[model samples]
Target chain A: SQQGEEDPQALSIQEGENATMNCSYKTSINNLQWYRQNSGRGLVHLILIRSNEREKHSGRLRVTLDTSKKSSSLLITASRAADTASYFCATGGQKLVFGQGTRLTINP
Target chain B: SAVISQKPSRDICQRGTSLTIQCQVDSQVTMMFWYRQQPGQSLTLIATANQGSEATYESGFVIDKFPISRPNLTFSTLTVSNMSPEDSSIYLCSVEINVRQYFGPGTRLTVL
Candidate 1:
């Protein structure tokens, strides 16, 4: 079964705008990871937030985790057209369960 | 993070034929994962490729349809047997490091 579910299924924004995506999961997990996939390409690890950690940052990306709520959110600041892709949230356990994903489109 | 590479970046095969997709990591990794993403669908874990051991497959996936091989820490392969149109999807290989997981470029398979 899929553990995570991302909200807003799709988001359209202009370049330089900030984009936010939310993910909710059903199980207790050790960590939650976010990944981005370009068209016809593989997934690239964007960020990871551990259960004990509330927030983390990497360059333009910020991830916040709320284990109590079983949810997480990814914030991309100053988004660009190249950022258009499918973003997924995966919860780690014996195996990782990925969210349905949110497709973000940055209009140039 | 490890640099992962997959062979046969993409392929078009006839139904009933089998194709093996190979993944090679630049460095050693203890755990490797295989995933399949159907068109416009989320990724599903295929199996956990443990070096020198039989792979652990996910529910709804079996060793028969998708056979996995992990010869060592840096190399693994997944084969799609008796391919059908439904088997066409993007196959990816992944490995984790310091809590972050990296994926291969993926192999795009099309069965007709």
Candidate 2:
């Protein structure tokens, strides 16, 4: 079974705007990781937030995790056209289960 | 970070034919995973391969349909047996190191 479910299956935004994607999981997890995949390419690891961490940031990316709610959110500040891709959230434990990613499009 | 490579970046196969995808990691890893991504769909875990043991497949996947071999820590192979049109998808291999995982460029398989 899929452990995570991302909201807003697709998102369209203009460059310089911020993009926010939310993910909800069904079970407890040691950590939650976000990944980005370009067209016809492999997935790239973006950021990881542990259950204990409520929020974390890296450059333009911000990840917030709410263990009590079993939900997480990823925010990309000043989105760029190059950021157009599928973003996935994975919950980690004995194994990592991926969600049906959110496809983000940044219009130039 | 570890570098992962997969052979036969893409292939077009006829139904009933079989294709084996190979994955090699630059560094040894205890845990490796295989995932399949259908067109416009989320990735699904196929199995977990560990060195020196049989691969453990997911609930929906079976050994007869997708046999996996992990001979050592750095290399593994997943074979699609008796393929059909429904088997068409991108097969990816990933290796876990510490807490982060690195993925290989997937193999795009088209079964006609």
Candidate 3:
């Protein structure tokens, strides 16, 4: 069974707006990672945060991990039309277990 | 980052037949995994491909139904044996590089 539970399965926002997606996992994890898949294609690694780290940023992506709560959030700032894609949060390092993804649509 | 590729990006196979998807990594990797993703669904881990050994399948998955071969560090193959319509999904192989993971272009299989 999948261990991660994600919220807001779908979201629509205007270009330049900020988008946030949350994921909560049932078990303790050593790290959490985010990935984006476009048009049912191969996934692109977005960002990964270690359990010891609270937050990390990469370009327009900001990810925060709260190990105490076993939850993590991904924030996309200044979202662009190209950011329209399905995003998933995965737990476990080598044998990753992915959560049901959040579909984000950036309306231009 | 690792460069991974899977052959026969997509295929339509007849029921009861089998299809083998090959995954090749640019560099040698210690860990490789296979996953199945149904339409608009999350990825479900099928098994872990351990080099020079049999794969470790997850719950509900077995070696006979999905036989795997990891002949070396940079190459692995997953075969969907005696496929059924329910096996229609995107099969992806990924490699773990330096604690990070990289995915290959998925092989979309449709068992008719």
* Local distance difference test, each candidate: 0.92, 0.92, 0.93
Position B9, candidate 3: lDDT = 96
Pick by DockQ: which candidate is best? Answer: 3
lDDT of 3 by residue, A1-108 (tens): 897788899999999999999999989999999999998878999998999999999999999999889999999999999999999999988999999999999999
lDDT of 1 by residue, A1-108 (tens): 778689889999999999999999998889899999999689988888889999999999999999999999999999999999999999874367899999999999
Q: After aligning candidate 3 to the native by TM-score, how far in Å is the CA of B16 from where it should be?
A: 1.0
Off by over 4 Å in 1: none
Query: Residue A102 lDDT in model 1?
Result: 95
List DockQ for all candidates. Answer: 0.71, 0.65, 0.87
**Tens digit of lDDT per residue, candidate 2, span B1-112?**
9999999899999999999999999998898999999988888889999898888999999999999999988999999999999999999999887788889999999999
Give me the candidate number with maximum lDDT. Answer: 3
Report how large a share of the reference interface contacts model 2 reproduces.
0.54
Cα lDDT tens digits, model 2, A1-108, are 888689889999999999999999998888999999999578999998988999999999999999999999999999999999999999864467889899999999
By DockQ, is 1 or 3 better? Answer: 3
- Cα lDDT tens digits for candidate 1, B2-108: 89999989999999999999999999998899999999889899999999889999999999999999998999999999999999999999887776788899999
